[model samples]
Each structure stands twice: as structure tokens, then as C-alpha cells.
Target chain A: MTPETARRKMTGTWSAHSPLTDVPAAVDTELAAFFRARHADYDDIDPVVADAVGALELFVTGGGKRLRPVFAWAGLRAALEGGGGSLTAPTGPGDVLRAVSSLEFIQACALIHDDIIDQSDTRRGRPTTHRRFSALHSERGWTGDPARYGESQAILVGDLSFSWADDMFADSGVDAAALTRARQPWRKMRTEVIAGQMLDIALENSGSEDPGAALKVDVYKTAAYTVERPLHLGAALGDADARTVSLLRKVGREIGVAFQLEDDHLGVFGDPAVTGKESGDDLRSGKRTWLLMCALDRADRSDPAAASRLRTGIGAVETDAEIDELRQIIVDSGAAEQNSARVRELTSDAVDTLRSCHLASPFVDELVALAEQLTERRS
Target chain B: MTPETARRKMTGTWSAHSPLTDVPAAVDTELAAFFRARHADYDDIDPVVADAVGALELFVTGGGKRLRPVFAWAGLRAALEGGGGSLTAPTGPGDVLRAVSSLEFIQACALIHDDIIDQSDTRRGRPTTHRRFSALHSERGWTGDPARYGESQAILVGDLSFSWADDMFADSGVDAAALTRARQPWRKMRTEVIAGQMLDIALENSGSEDPGAALKVDVYKTAAYTVERPLHLGAALGDADARTVSLLRKVGREIGVAFQLEDDHLGVFGDPAVTGKESGDDLRSGKRTWLLMCALDRADRSDPAAASRLRTGIGAVETDAEIDELRQIIVDSGAAEQNSARVRELTSDAVDTLRSCHLASPFVDELVALAEQLTERRS
Candidate 1:
């Protein structure tokens, strides 16, 4: 089928409802197939090796929004249907899907390593990889420190995911020329995200109270990696011109920043049942996030004593009462409300950009819905 | 120049001395050039990131035998001048050099992660990456757990190396078809080494007493990744046929095993001044090396009490007297002698295979000399 006709038919199927509903399953299906092939290849080597791969597979298929892939697909669709360029739709949607699925592996790498750094016990309501392996050591009556063993295994597993992510991207069945084009953004994304992560660690280590520091971390760690680069990659795959890539990047950055701001809000105040994370988990870990910075800023300006209490309680092991007090302090300081206002403004700006861009009407609408969903959702 | 004439000139430069002496400088030069470009690219992003990259540079250039790259270059040389094939000398030696240097980055990744796993304080007479960073945290009086912050930085640094390794390989300026061929061994090497590392961890955790278990670890962890796969990668880059690749693999595997066996002996018995490692480090860490397995086996057959004593002494924070006793037991058990004999035998077999193969004469000679240098070394 012609690119336009195929897209039209697909759009028709989604015309009655939101496109976000189908994305998770589609991305999961692609990842599952990839893991099946990996399992077969590795199983032939040794069951032990297969098990390592299996652990990673479980982590990948377990839970995620699959937002990066969705953004990538929308970017490609926008590039193809927007009409002012010679760039055409990818001949094989399967290849694009596989290529985009690599983003999830990158996420897996980040989360696995992040969990270790945070010393987190659970994620998505399941035992973190290191914790799971640590428990295995204890159950099996293994020697050495179980924590060390678990941490080591998790590190290797994270390394494996990183390697496999690259392999998947390279072997995505895209033509060589297109693959080369996609690599610029891909390489930058990997480097920038890691650098961003390093910056976060550095900020936390230094106990910096600078608000600008947190925003820089957010831009590199969340904004570029989660959205801007993925969209740029997709545009590259579609052979989009510079102007189109620039436009998508602007939209992606605003939405990504808004998404992370909402996350910061949820991290402190959302219900554990809904968010799948314990409320105040980030505060407990003493992450130097934008929300924490904003809270500190406001508290310092209005109530010095409240700011002192917040500082003392932020990075410590806190009881339920202390957590509630800190929450109150943040709320009373007006940081939460201000943060929410920024999210709304950024979401609105992203939607406006999407609407004003020369992208296809259907893609623009879907993107607008996605922005709203991201900014407004509890989780 | 013709392939033969180029081979003649290159061989003449090395006729008076060992090839190993020149390899380190050549590989480092290539690596230095690569890092310079990377620094320029990353420095534009953030000085902090530039500093992180700088740390990796220090780690890479600090000290290493550069064995993998040496083996890769030898394999390429053997392929180019081996009489039976249409394969010629690489038109650009610079490309092969850069490609070979990528092995160093992979080694850096392994070392960084291994330091974290082993909780090692120093390597090659310097503090390990994690320890270095941890010390930095203390010096700076950073908040939170200094150890965690250091470890987190090291993990990201390792990740950066892994990513950069792939980028270097892809951009090595080799023809794309040759690179595609090289990638097969490259991918397998990465996966197998990680699997081998996991096996080592499992064996340590399970407290496996079986000598064969350690040997299996050595084969996968050391032999394949360090030698066989690197040679295969080089041969592939040279477009060598399957028979030549197989020959190199066989030669590499035997020599690689010998290399690790020697390393194990050095870990326990060699003078700290010579080995640059505190003697008994492997024992202290309870690494499941073949030497330890052999010692246990011999001790079990002759003296059960000695075996028991050896078991107790291993994996403990021992006094100097205990370490001395352990050394005596290892020597008295005849395990150390037997292990040395095995190394000699393996090295001989590797040389025999290299001589029998229809490879270039000078390269074969160098390979034989390298095997001797690897196995007969004191450290």
C-alpha cells in the first residue's frame, strides 16, 4: 500500500478513540518478540546466560508508558504527512517500530542503574533487579555478602541492556544510509543522558540548593533523552529536513519538561497505589529535583524556620509525621502550586506548537492529547 | 605499495626486537587522538562532563598491557600475508589501529565495573575509579553516602566507555562490509564475557569447590574475550576466510587460558613489587580461579587438614602469618607447580598451532614469542 493510504487507514482505525491506548501493547509485542529471539540465541550457550537475559526481559516487559516510542512514531507520521518536503514515510513500519523499541532498552539500562544508585528496593511494585538477586543469594545459601552479589549482578545486567540496545538499533533492518542518519541523535542521546545522570549525582553529592542546577539536570536527564532526541531520531529516520526536526524538537522539549515537572509533583504528593511508588520516595533518597529546589526557594523567602525544617527532614529517614510535615511545608511555601502552574503553561505551549506546526492534522491532534494526558495524569 | 612490499617494510622495522614493545605506544597514540576529538565534542556540552571524560582518559592511558589490541593487530597481520587468500593488507592501517584500540575501551568498562564488584581500592598501583571518586567525595565533604555517590559516578563512567567503544568501532573508517563482518565476533565477545563474569560471580556465591567450575570460568571470562574473539574480530576485519579464523581462534584460546593461569599464580605468589598487586588478593577476594581450584584438589587428596585450613584461610581478612601459611599450603600441595606446568604446556601448544597455520612467517614468530612472554612472565 502507498504510504499515504496506509497511514489514512491506520488513522481511521484510531479516529474513534485515542492512539495512546494501543501504543503500550504494540511496543510490548515488539519487545517480546525481540526477547524471544534473544532467549533462543542465549539459551543455546548456557542456561545461566539465558537466565541473565531473562531477567532483563522481565524488566523490559514489566511496566512502562512506552512514551518515547509513541513520540517517535508521531514524529515520523508528522514528517511523512506534513507535505512540504521530499522526505517519505519509511517503507517498512516494522523496521521503524523495532528501531523505536530500542528506546525502552535504554530506559531499562537507566532504571536498573538508577535503582542501584538509589538503593531502591522496589520498582513498579516489584523487587528491583539487585534486590531480587540479593534475595536469591540469601535463599540459595550463597556465600559472600548478598548485597554485594546482587549489586554486581545488577551492574552486569545493566551493561548487557546497554549493549543489546545498541545492537537492536543497528540491526533494526533500516537501510544503512538511514541508520547512519539516525545515529547522530542516538549517540548524542546516550551521552547526554549519562552526563545528565552524572550531573544529578554530583548535585546531590554537593548538596547544592541552586534552582538552576535542578533545571539543568531536568533538561539533560529528562527533557532531551525522553523526548527531544527520540523525536529527532524519528524525524531523521523519515529523512525529515532540518526545519521539521527543529520544530519537533521544540515541541518535544516543552512537553518533556512539563512531563518531568508533573513527575516531581507526583513523586512527593501522589498516592502510592496510583503512582506505583511510595510517596516521598524521592525526598527520602534526597534527589536534587526541581520540585525540591522550588520548595527550598519559596521556604527561604517566606519562612526561615520552615526552610530549616524542610532541609533537616529532606534527606533523612523520616517517620510518617515528619513526611507529612515536610509535605505541608512544601505546600504552604507555594512551591507545589507554582510547579503545577509551570507544568500547565509548558503543556499549553507544547500543544500550541504542535497545532501551529505544519504536521498532519491527525498527528497534531494526537500529540495535543498526549501532552494533556502527560501533564494532567496522577501517575 | 603492494601488500607483500608493505608487509616487508613493516616486518623490517620489527626484525631487531619484539613487537610487543612498540604496541603500547601505537595503541595509545590512536586512543589519545580519539579522546581528543571526544573531549572537543563533550566540552562544548559541559565542563563537568569533560572532566568525567578526562577521568576515563586517565584510566585508559594510566597503565595496561594492551594485550587485546596487540592480538587483534597480529591477527590482521597474519591474515594479510597468509599465502592462500585473496585478502590484502588493510589500505588504511590507521583504521585498523583505531578499531583495535576500541578493545581498550571495552577493557576499561570491564575494569570499572569489576572494581565496583570487587570493592577494590587500587589497581595497577593506583586507586580504582570508584575509590578515586569516593575519596573525592570525602575530600569535598559531599553529603549523602560517599560510597554510593562514588559508585554511581563510576557506573556512569563505565557506561560512557561502553557507548564510546561502539562509536569508535563504527567510525573506525573501515569499509562498511568489513565492519559488518567484524561485528559478529564483537557482539559475541561482549555477551560471552558478561556471561563469563556472571558465572564467576555465581561460582563465588555458591562456594563451588569443583576445579572444573573455575576452568569453565577461565575459558569464558578470560580465554574467549581476551584472545579468541579479538583475533576473530581482526580476521573478520581483514576478510579472512573461516579456516583462517578458526585457526586463529584455536591458537588464541590456548594462549589466553595460559595467560589467565599465569595471572592467577601472580595474584597469589608473585612479589608485590613485581606484580603491583598485594599478594593473596585473589585469595582474600575468594576469586574462583583455576589455581585455587587446583590447590584445593591437591590438598584434598594428600591432606584433608591442609585442605580445611586452606578453605578457612581463603576469603578472610587474614593476618600476614595466615597469608604465609596459605601460601605454604598452596606450594606444598603441588598445585602451584602443576598450574605452572599447565601454562607451559598451553603456551607450547599455542605456538605449535601458530607455526602449523599457513600464516605470515613474521607474524607467526611474533605470536609464538607473545605466548612465551604471556605464560613465562613473573607478573
Candidate 2:
């Protein structure tokens, strides 16, 4: 994503609501109330746990686009909306609402667990839980290995939240059949999120040390979990026929790839202030993104020594000059341009799928707009 | 615990089931088929994951007391059994059976996650998932770090199992109101188990670092999570009133302490081969169990230098003669006998709670018996 892509000042968001105006507020209210209820006496918990869980409460309720929850409601509504022949629900909204809310919890669990595994120190400008706890452990001179203990505690916190999220969604109003139907995508969401996480880790770790494994990591790690599953889940609930589901997955394929492309672009070119991330952070970490993948391919034919330099911590803070060198290598290899074209092609293909669905529903336009904007977002 | 405790095994394992001995076989058939159907494609999965998942299928189907499920079934029967000498069930046995099977899944989730958090490499002589994956990680040149990736995957796998377990029970038809009542305790069970996991971590990490925080960790971690929550969940499903729930918690208090005490004792005195653990590992690890707490208290008064020596892990994995000297110091401190006596008092008190409940159900005896056996077992 370049500054040119960020030029759309009135950039619109796509949501499942029949009219986009009402979606954000409704999602906020529903999700805020759900958090309020779960943490009604949040401070009254065991003192040791109170502070940590409170931090989580703040992280969740702080703010986001509410895209995940909106997709859930829209998906459910899309499924049952026509069954009632209006932009209203046919079934009681309790179970679906609970189910949708549970995804937010799922998101929270993932973020926490992800932070711990990544050894990331801050999230959304606050210290990560393991870092926070390890700091506390140091101050206290805790008995066992502080780092290991901190990691263990973080693991428990993540696991606890994971279980609570499921229990919350197990509402009685959702009949067995509806639940069983709904659970297929639900199953994939869990499995794929985890699979994607593995790939992300593998690509970072594997280097010229093992190039083949790193590429596979990119597919399973990012493309499938983050975008593909979320869209499929929405379609599944929207009463999609097999054709519609297939198209939706294709839509996911394009958006998911482009989403990663935009991410990689932002990693190098975007402003740290706007992204609320340090500049060159991914480069410092030596991530094997799509841009890197293409560069490696080009280097296999030419400039093998240059590719070797790109394999190690060429992006580390200590190697400041290497950042520019690394960026140039990516661009000069023609990998950057190739991936840029791929992004455009995928986004165009996704738009075609939306058109071919041929539904007269006015929401189709917004979906198409979303796919286009998604690939082009600067941050 | 000693062989004297394990030797007094209660003999009438299935005597009470003579009236309907057919029930066990029926339950076994249903459960076995469930595993076979669910895991029919086990051979097709990654050998390691296939083995991890397959282990659960085998273990669940393998004989344990099945005491938890049996209690659930009996309670459902007792609650719904015909009141006026009718032969037909007030509720179908299948309904109770399904609910009971769900409880088994919950138990499995607890055991698997516990093994990961505890870093225990084996369960009943088989390698744990982390250990298996740790070994596999060594074989594969997985990109950055395979053990970290493996642990994360194991956590996710446990999470998947836990969610699936909750789903199995979510739609179980024990009547809408009954499920509604079960919801609170069931929800609490999830929360408490997590809180307890935190407490366990805290206790293990406490050492002599933070004296003030140590005591609270002891009370909240094991006592509340392990002993208390399981009983509460069982009683809630059995339709126990608030007074009974409170009573059950008190029973948990007594039993949980004894359970931990017995655990500490086994960690010391139990044979390595029979217990499937190296004896005195706690002492070697410098774990601050109650026995160690008692020893420290004694040494502080009688011989200051001895306390320091004990804390240093002086004889931890040392020559046998050095270990004997350390063992003698612990004996001179009289920590073992004191902790054992406490276990005796608490175990007796836990049994007394059942006696006074006056429920006059066979479940009361079995539960009491289970508690006693758990606290007394040598291996």
C-alpha cells in the first residue's frame, strides 16, 4: 500500500447490514454490553488476576473497526434475512448474537496467545502480558525461572479466555441442526487460525536454512486463516448455496492474498506513526513475506551473494544501512512489482466473483468496494 | 501415600450395578463407536498429530473408573426417575447417557492441558504431546524454532478439544430448565479451572522469593480449582441446592488440601518405577510444597544453616549419601509426619461431609470413596 492508495479521504467500510449507516453503532453497543456483562465485577476478582484481566478488558473494549463482529452479524442476517423476506431476523437473535460475540473473544484469545508466542513487547501501544508479568516477576524475585513462569501464566490466561468464549456461545436457542450447520465454518476458523499462526512462525525461522518450508508457511500462515476463513464463516451463515460458498471462498482467496501484499508493502513503505508500529519492524525481524519470496526466486538465477545477505538479520536494528539495501534488493529483483501486479489481478478476480453472483441485492456493491479498498489500504 | 493406602483397594467395583449390569456395556458401546466414527480418518493425519489425537481416543475408551460419568448418569436418573413406582424412566437414559459422555470429554480436556502446563512428559508411562513434539522438532529443521511452534500447536489442539467438548454438551437434552441451571456451574467450572492453573504456576514459582504471595497461591490454586470445581460441577448437574453447593465446596476445601498433600508426599516417598516419576524431584527442584514449608519453619528455629542447605538443592541429584543426609535433615524437621497428619485430618473431614449430607444415594459413597482413594493412593 502506497500513499496513493491512502489518498481516498472518504474511504468507506463494507458491512453486512442492509444499510451501512447502522452497522457500526449496533456492533459497538452489542459488543460493549457483552464485555460489560462478562466483566460486571471485573475488579472483584482475585487481586493477582484482577489487574491482568482488567488490562484485557481495556484492550478489547478500547476500539477497532469492529469488522469481525460485523461480519458475523451480517453473515447471520444474510443467512436468515431472506428467510423472513426483510432485513430482519427469522430466528431469535440471542444465539447468533452470542455466537458473534464469541468471535470477539476468539480474537482476544488469539491476540494474547500470539503476543506471547511472538515475544512481542507491546500491543496497540501497551506492554504485552508476558513482558508485564516478567517485569513483575523480576521485581518480586520469584522462585522459579521468571521468563518460563511468565510464559506459563500467559498460556493459562489465554486458555481460560478460550474456554469462556466457547461457553458463552453455547446458547440454548440455537438448535442442534442450526448449530451443526454453523459449526463447520466454526471448526475451520479455529483450525485454520492455528495453522496460519504456525506458518507465520515457520517462515520467520526458516531461512536460506530451509527455503522450501518457508514458502509453504506463507500460504497456511496468512492466506487461509486471517481472510479466507472469516469470509467463509460469513457466507456459511448467510444461507449460501454451494455455488455461493464456492464464490465466497474465491472472493476470500483474492482478498486474502492482496491483504498480505498490502501488509508487506506497508511493512517497508508505510509510516510508523500512522501504523502505530515501528518502522522496518518486520524487516528487522527477517520476515519471509511475499515480497521476500519473489526476491529469493530472482536471486536463485542471479546475485546469489545478495540473496545470502537478505537471509539473515539484514533488518535488525543494529544493521540500519541494511534496511535500504534490503528494500532495494526486493525492488530490483522485480519481486515487488510482480507481487504488486498479483495483488491487482486477485482483487479484480474477486470483483468479478461478486458480479457473477448476480444477486440484485444492493449490498453487493459495498462488498465489491470492500474487496478493492482492502487490497489498496495503506495501513 | 504408602502402599498401605493403595493396598486397601475397595473391592466391590461393579457390585452396585448388578441390577442393571447391562448399562456399562451399553455405555461402552456408544462411547467406543463415537470415537471410532470421529477418528476413522486418524491414519490419514500427520503421524505425530494422529498419534496425539489417537491417544485420547484410546485413553477415553480404556478403562478408568468412569466414575464421573457414572455419577452423572445416576444423578440424572435419580432426578428424573419415576416417583410413584413406575418402571419407565422419567427421562430417557439416552439423554443422561449423552450428557455423561460430554463430562468425559471435559475430563479429557483438563488432563491434556494440565500435562502441558505441568511439563510432565509422560502420563501413565506414555509420552505427553509436548515431549513427542519436542522430539519431533529436533528431527525436523523447522524454520526458526520448532519447540515453540509445537507448544503453541499443542495448546491449540487442547483448545479445539475443549470447545468440541462444550459443544457436545451444549445441545444435550436434559430439559431446557435443567440445562439453564447447569449453565452457571458449568461456566464457573471453566473459569475456576483456569484460575487454578494460574495459582499452580504461582505456587511453583514462589520459592522463597515472595513469602506474602505464597500463602494465597496455595489456597486459591489447587484447593479451589481442582478439588472444588469438579465436585461443584457434579453437584450442580445433580440439582443440588445452594446450601448443598456450599457444603460441597467445603468438602472440596478439605479434600483439595489433602489431595495436594498426598501429591507432595508422593513426589517425595513414592518409588520412581511405580509412580512413573523420580522420587524427591520436588526437593531437587526446590518446589515450595507444604512439606518444604514445614521443614523451613522447623529449620529456621532449630538450625539456621540447615535451612539454607535445604533451600540450596544441596543434595538434589547428588550422591546417594548426600541425599540421605538431606533426607535425614527433612526427617529431623518432622515435616513429612506433620503434613501426613494434616492430610489425614482433612481426608476424614471430607468424608464426614458426605456422611452428614444425608442424601442416602449411592453416589455419595462412590464420591466419598473416590476422594479418599485419590488422597491416599501411593502411585
Predicted structure with the largest DockQ when compared to the true one: 1
Top lDDT model: 1
lDDT of 1 at A10: 53
Q: Chain A alone, model 1, TM-score?
A: 0.91
State each model's CA lDDT, in order: 0.82, 0.60
Q: Which candidate is the best by TM-score?
A: 1
Provide per-model DockQ scores. Answer: 0.69, 0.38
Over 4 Å off in model 1, which ranges? A1-21, A44-47, A83-91, A279-285, A316-325, B1-21, B44-47, B83-91, B317-325
- Compared to the true structure, candidate 1 yields what TM-score? 0.91
Candidate 2 clash pair list: A79-A238, A196-A221, A205-B143, A205-B144, A206-B143, A284-A315
Q: Write the per-residue lDDT of candidate 1 for residues B77-147, one digit (tens) a residue.
A: 76676823333334366677678889999999999999999888888778989888888889989877888
Model 2 lDDT tens row, A22-44: 44454445556665766664335
Per-candidate TM-score, chain A: 0.91, 0.83
* Candidate 2: TM-score, chain B only: 0.76
